[model samples]
Target: MKNTYFLKAVFTLILCGFFSMTYAGTIYLSATGNDSNNGLSMGTAVKSFSVAQGLAADGDTIMVSGLIDFVNDPGNTATTTTSGPSTTNKVGIVITKNLNIQGTSSDTDGFQGVDTQTFINTRFIQLTADFTLGLKNLKLINGALITDLTTVAAGGGAILMTNGAIVAENVVFDSNTTSGHSAISGGAIYIGGSNGSGKATSFKNCVFNANEGTKGGPIYIQSVGNGGKITFEGCAITNNLANGTTGGSAFYIRFNAPTGKPEINIINCTIRGNKVTANNANGGAINWSAKTPNTAYVNIVNSTITENTTGGSSTAGAGIYFAFGTNATGNYGNLTVSNCIVEGNKTDAGVASDMQVKADAATGTAPENTVGYIAVKNSMIGAVTSLAANVPTANITDATYYNYITTLTPDLKAMLVRNNPDDLKVRYYTLGDGSPAITFGKSTFLSPITTDQLGKTRPSTTDISAGSVEKNPVLGLRKNLDSAILVYRNANNQITVENSTNDYTGSITVYNTLGQVVAKTAATGARTTIEKSLNAGVYIVRLNTTAGSAAKKVIIN
Candidate 1:
């Protein structure tokens, strides 16, 4: 019996060692190298990224030493490449197996991942097969896409991902774009292809700037085949343009079928200065259309969406658009806007310019399919609304539909000296001295507050700021802010808000379950109370102060 066990263990070790020996190792690629070389070491590097990809096996590492330039390749013809999407045969590499593309340097500048020196220009990287792709410390610029006249399958100007998982860190996609054709989408990256098992797609510390596309300037996710989670953390999407009328200049996510659960998270990021230049475009930065049988979830937490612009005069959501397509009635979707600063945007959607909720589009989907569920809390925005079942846009009768569109006009640029390092094209909004966003974030709205984008330690729950940029306290309102401003029902059935903090002074409102304000009054001095006779019910008490705004639940007997 002891001899049998020892032989079994020895066999297992031999098998493990054999598998480890069969695993592919590293392959080096350089601009000045030759394809005839072995590509096994730095001295014997290959010239073409495509050649290196063909030579390597699954799980092989491609250590890129020199900038890979596709346009200046030695001898290649018949294939075409452009700065954006086209109907040409794109000259690029097709990734067929699992691999890692690592660059020489991985310098990070907050949301900006690239410096002025390192760059790699490629036409495209088509991932048609199911393979996990890992990219680190690399910049893909001027990547384009190709599509035939009929099929709309060719999207993703730079990285066309359809199957498997993609984990890219410290990567920058700049000036990548697709054509203005009505069928094409995704300027930088496109994720859509029937249940291809794309469950592990996440981008960390990435930057997407100056890209152009038809639907989504930088990204368009049609579907992921099965259950998938797409996340963008500590990233910046800026200065891109969406040429098509279907908006989402920064990102457009559309659900065509309920193939699987699709979730997208935008945490600790900045989406700014994007544009939708089409005549009837909406959602200057993001357009979300759970327009089919989709159970999707979108969480925009601890982010900043500002200065996004839409072209149409009657457009909605300069920062974001909650959309519904034809035949999208019975579908359900959820949006949570927490600890965000979505102000200073350009939109013509009434008083809510920063963000808009419009179930008003009539074409495309059935009228029964255009409604959704949304919650906007503890954020500074231009406007927000609620979502009811089977309704496009309904009255705010419940807590799910909420809005706090203030005219604070927070000083967003160069307000105070931030700890952000200099980048090649990095842009971040720093809250000025006494900016309203500085201690206006609601900690309980989402998760516990920890650090900001630049890795600044935040205060406790009561004193956190709203946007991704956490500011140092000039007044230090990050402690006991709730105790400084109190809102309660008086003995005479009146709503009273006592503000011991001088930074808070604006208005107070009392909303009942039926979405009607039973009482409202201007806030002034130290103690301000609204005299209103009320009955027994639970209500939502909201306070809009100069520094920021907050809401609470109150019960009156």
Candidate 2:
């Protein structure tokens, strides 16, 4: 029995050693190949990223040196290379595992993978299985092509992360292309599961810039079947253009309905300078949605969204458009935007009355607002125009109107709008000093407050809009006026008015709009209630005391 035990232990040691050796395979690729099978050593470097990928296993590493060219055959132009030729192919490298693909320099940026024009017109990186594709300290860019038609079709040029987990650290996605005008496309990085909740993906510390496509010019996440979850952290997505009217510029996450799943979380990211242009395009920095049971959970914390535009025949969010994945009735999903800055997003060409918040139904109609909800707490949100210009005053609680619009023409609205029903409310505090968005909110977000585009703490106590907060206590009533009103609302929407020089023991009189004394009461100790029938309109309520009187407008809706 002792001999048997010893043999077993020895066998286990041998197996561990073998497994470690297999996992330790690190193949290097460069402009020159050593033409040796010993890929574990740098001296025996492989010729291309494809050869390295073929030699790698699940957790292997691929170290790239010098300018390595990858060919992509999106159109299946070559009978020789299923992937692509080393010269003018469609895709350069296809990732199949949780491998670390890295470059030598930290300052330089270029495409870790490249996809060019092709006859078959396929995706740049078509991910068929589940894996983790990591691009470390590299750049991927520019997806454009001129096809048979007179017009040019562009996109689907960067990393494609489908049915798996994708991560890019300090990488850039820039110019590349697949089809011309007729391109079935995505650019930068496209993530999603199979049809029906089968894929999961995420990206961190990445940059997506100057990438163009028909839909999802920079990044697209389409999760079918229960949908999938996509998370972005410490990344910058900017200057990406999505062509056509309906495409989204920077990020477009859409899922199917009913059994659809949602798991979209964006944290500590910067999304700016992206455009969804002309015709039905959504120019927002990020457009995310979940369908039916699949709730698109978008949590943008400690991030900044600015200088993004969305417009054309119809327009929506310049910063973000959060909704239910399903384009069906009453299927609006859920959204939670906390600790972020969404400012400076606008419609095309100086359009007026662009809103910052818009909520509508899926079918591009109206009156099915129950499909989704938005909850924006402890954050800063304001617009170029006054809040009144965004929605009709009567629709504050007009559930029928919101529902009908969201269900009918969800995207046929004006510029820079946010859609958050009563279920999805926005709350935040004020900023200090010279800031535009000081004291400009109905509520205050409370979590790790979002910083500005330059990484400054968004003030939460005294400001109404972004880049503005009132910190000096010396300023009297106007100090954070919007926040003060919100605070009053927090106190059950009841306010007491009094002259600063008055005492509390005087009798107070209340009157109606017809100059009739509706009720009278004594100011007992410090407060008194006005007893009168109040309707849904604004009413001027006056309180009389020994030092004179004070009148204020109270909205009782």
Best by TM-score: 1
lDDT of each: 0.68, 0.50
State in Å the error of residue 481, model 1.
5.6
lDDT of 2 by residue, 1-557 (tens): 99999999999999999987765567776546553555666677765566677777777777876645444322223212323332233442455666777877534533333333442322335454666666687755443332333322223565554455665666666654433443335666555455333545556666666777666877666553355566666666767787755556777666554454456777656666777776455436676645445444555654556567777522466666654423443334555565455655667753421223344532222332333555554343434232332333332321211211222332321122222223112111233222322222222432343443234454455332322122221111122222222111114444344333334356644444444555566665434554444445444444444543334345565
Worst 10 residues of 2 by lDDT: 481-490
* Candidate 1 displacement at residue 239 in angstroms: 0.5
For residues 1-557, write the lDDT of model 1, one tens digit per residue: 99999999999999999987787689988767899998998899987777888778779999887566554444322233334343334535667788998886544211111123443233557676778889998877777654444445557777777667789998888888777356678989988764355456889888899998888999998775556788887788888999888888888987654556667888878888788897677666888877555666778888888768888643457787776533434334556677787766775443335666555332222332223556555566654422333222332212221344444633332233323544335456676543556666666653553777666777764657777877643322332244577767898987777788766678877777555778888888788878787899877666777776655557788
Count of clashing pairs, candidate 2: 115
* Alpha-carbon RMSD to native, per candidate: 11.4, 13.0
* Consecutive 10-residue window with the lowest summed lDDT within model 1: 107-116
